[model samples]
Target: MAHAKVKRLPVVDHVGMLQGIVSRADLLKVFLRDDDEIAEEVRREVVAYLFAAPVSAVRVDVRNGVVTLTGHARDTSLVPMAARLVRAVEGVVDVEFELMRSEGPAEPMAAPANGGENLSRA
Candidate 1:
């Protein structure tokens, strides 16, 4: 009800954050963010955090809201972590990576304590 120029919106907080907005259009607004904006966010939020420039040259590319990470990193084991974080970014529809080991052999990521129920073959 707070939308538009409606002054003094007649809104009620029934459960105090319990009955929050549950609109499908609001949820679908995630895809409205541009690819370039998503790419920059991924580079700053994910790539810069997981793969630094000194050790890794990973490039962030976004197309149609799908983020694609390319290039090799020194710590290939962090691929899973990267994938997880990248998918957490807003406006990310999907994630696709073409990463490889920069030096040594790529090692599998450590299994989670919960048996890696959410883990993928990244």
Candidate 2:
């Protein structure tokens, strides 16, 4: 199976699943409230592992304790590998992945114009 990049989906608690209620806005709020620099650092670490594994078909974003991964991998079987990579990172409380299979070449990831540098000292 070809590897594809995946995006992180919103995670729901066991109770929320029973209720069929959970919102993306709520997840976003949780992400935004996280320590910015710490989140970024975790993201970087996750990305490093992903790339080093030779699974370059993915992107990572961290907000609060939630981690979102988006991209394509060469092997479908590598999806769990991606998740495991994020989980191994320190301070990650949740892992969400949104990976899709593609028949075509991978698209270029949008780079933040400012390099997403932290303005405040840690």
Candidate 3:
């Protein structure tokens, strides 16, 4: 409705049956949410559920319904998917990413014979 600048929309059921009508006011009422609420939803729903990662893995910061995501993830492919899911959340104004690819696991590097710290770069 807001996208088309229309005031009302026809509500439909699963079978495409007209259930009722939805006005712009109704949509606003449903979509309006606090910034913290939006951030929690994004963290719980998008990052934790969709990505199957702990909430700590992704840093979610929301201001005025705009979300900014940072931190690391093992699967970088899910970054775009996370963004889409965040956008789908109600009351989210926009999504931004500063996420870094996570190093899957730590490995011990071969030490020099001098018994010193490894100074060689990968």
- The candidate maximizing TM-score is 1
Clashing pairs in 1: none
Q: Please state the error at residue 112 of candidate 3 in Å.
A: 45
* Candidate 3 runs further than 4 Å off: 1-19, 50-54, 105-122
Ranking by lDDT: 3, 1, 2
Candidate 3: worst 10 consecutive residues by lDDT?
113-122
- Model 1: lDDT equals 0.70
Q: Candidate 2, residues 1-122: lDDT per residue as tens digits?
A: 01333333445677766434445555455345454654566445544433333335566666666777777654445557656655654456778878666555434433323453421221
State how far residue 9 of model 2 sits from its true place (Å).
36
**lDDT by residue (tens digit), candidate 1, 7-85:** 3323348655444444545656899999998898777666765666432478888989999888888787778888887
- Give Cα-based local distance difference scores for all models: 0.70, 0.53, 0.71
Candidate 3: C-alpha lDDT: 0.71
- Compute the lDDT of residue 90 as modeled in candidate 2: 49
lDDT (Cα, 0-100) at 28 in candidate 3: 76
Candidate 3 lDDT over 1-122, as tens digits, reads: 66788988898999999999989788676357888898876766666654454458778999888899988777777677677777877788789999887776522232233332211111
- TM-scores for candidates 1 onward, in order: 0.66, 0.42, 0.63
Arranged by TM-score with the best first, the candidates are 1, 3, 2
